[model samples]
Target: MIDVVAAILKQGDKILIARRKEGKSLGGYWEFPGGKIEEGESPEKSLIRELKEEMMIDIKVTEPFGENIHDYGDKKIRLIAFWGEIDSGEIVLKDHDCIEWVFPKDLHQYNFSPADVSFVEQLMK
Candidate 1:
């Protein structure tokens, strides 16, 4: 299974979510910003690097939030999620079509990637 990491970045009462670029894998679906973990990298470090690469923002990863493993017929992924906050830099999206800061209660309104649905349910609870 491919290992991935995602950041649930918080700013006040809002959480940051990004829309996958159209035509890409899981295109048009909203997800916690993150990417696949590279070789020889810890999940936390991978998340930090991914935030900088994908969103152009420096993040301070705080704690583990949750994880889920899902199969998409073509592939399986283990999604490791963590809590984080922006440390610096303005978000300049490089991989996403859009980004939003949404309250937990409103997260259900967006169409999220299937691998991320469990976390969304936990947050809504």
Candidate 2:
């Protein structure tokens, strides 16, 4: 299984989510900002790197939102989620088609990937 880290980046009462670009896996779906964990890197390091690479933002990955393993038919992934806030830099999207700051209660409106949908439920609690 692939290990991935996602950031539940909070700014006030809102959290950041990105729309996957067309042609990518789970394309057109909204999900938390993060990517696969590379070899020899911790989840925090991977998330910090991914945010910089994908969103051009620096973040201090704080507390865990929790973890889940999901089967996506062809592949299964162990998703490690952390909720944090932006530490520095403005967001400049390099990968996703769009980005939005959504309140946890309203997250259900967006079409999120299955794994991130679970994260949303946790946030609402």
Candidate 1 stretches greater than 4 Å from native: none
Candidate 1 lDDT, 1-125, residue by residue in tens: 99999999999999999999998999999999999999999999999999888878899999999999999999999999999999999999888989999999999999999999999999999
**What lDDT does candidate 1 reach at residue 36?**
98
Best by lDDT: 1
Per-residue alpha-carbon lDDT of candidate 2 for residues 41-84, written as tens digits (9 for 90 to 100): 99999999999999988999888889999999899999999989
lDDT of each: 0.96, 0.92
- Count of clashes in candidate 1: 0
For model 2 the TM-score comes to 0.96
TM, every model = 0.98, 0.96
The best candidate by TM-score is 1
